[model samples]
Target: MRPHRCWRPAAGGWLGRRLLRPPGALPEPFFLGLCLRCGQCAQACPRSAIRIARWEHGLSTGTPYIAARETACDLCGGQAPACAAVCPTQALHLEPGEPVRMGTAVIDATRCLAHMGDICRSCFNACPLRGRAIVLEGALRPVVDPALCTGCGLCEEHCLVEPAAIHVEPLNP
Candidate 1:
């Protein structure tokens, strides 16, 4: 039998697996085994950020995940995360007030307008958590605060640059 290949960003491989999982997702191994693939999570998402894993995902097929660049999780406004609330299996268990660390945003300095000495604050302004999750450094350069970031990907979705100057790197843990 072939061994499973978990996605790793540094390797620049597994491009398709770079998708971000919904908030409160279990670790990948457990999530793959426990998720019922009922697509309830996808249906519950107001932003339509969560999607069922496709056939190309191999063993992970039918699980819910997010592609932040396309659509980002909005945490469902004032309510609990909708996707997790609708999950039949406990695969997406999230306690109330629990923080989600979906992934971290990394800015590519070469492509970032603010980092290049431009005055772009799109990323900073678009962040739902604003000053807490993303802060402006020198020259209004947006810097992600990993400790507070929920990896909701709103910043990535709002980035004006082609190919996006800042992107979320999925956290497998």
Candidate 2:
């Protein structure tokens, strides 16, 4: 006999005006919501792309923040996000092969720790599309190569510091 696939609860999930909500007890979207925020999506992630946002973003407190650090649906291939599969939330709106507009990654050299005098290259290393997407503007700073950039937000996500020097913005909407 097959065992029952019981679901668990995720702590400190974030809610937004744009996001869809379901019902009671299970936070906002009941029935459909069943995530434990255990970070399975991050682990299964081939790119190590998923990220959970902190309190600093304001809009997203404990919720999963994908846009800021690593945008672009590289894993989806014009389909759905793998991370959502782990999410109990029908909250993540898991769809098959749905075309998604991923956010774009950007770098603010002036504010970047690398540019500010820190010998940090976290952003450069974090970018999956390295060499093509992001490149060294100088010994101290990095620049985003628009020509080679798929606009993946990895650089923004793994900045290794607060007020992320790299910022990922939504595509032209």
Top-lDDT structure, candidate number? 1
Over 4 Å off in model 1, which ranges?
A: 1-16
Q: List the global CA lDDT of all models.
A: 0.82, 0.52
lDDT tens readout by residue for model 2, 65-155: 3454334235444334566666654545435644333445677767788888788888788776666577777655777766555445557
| Clash pairs (backbone) in predicted model 1 | none
Query: Per-residue lDDT tens digits of candidate 1, residues 138-168?
Result: 6488888898888888899999998999998
- Candidate 2: minimum summed lDDT over ten consecutive residues — where? 16-25
RMSD of each: 3.5, 11.4
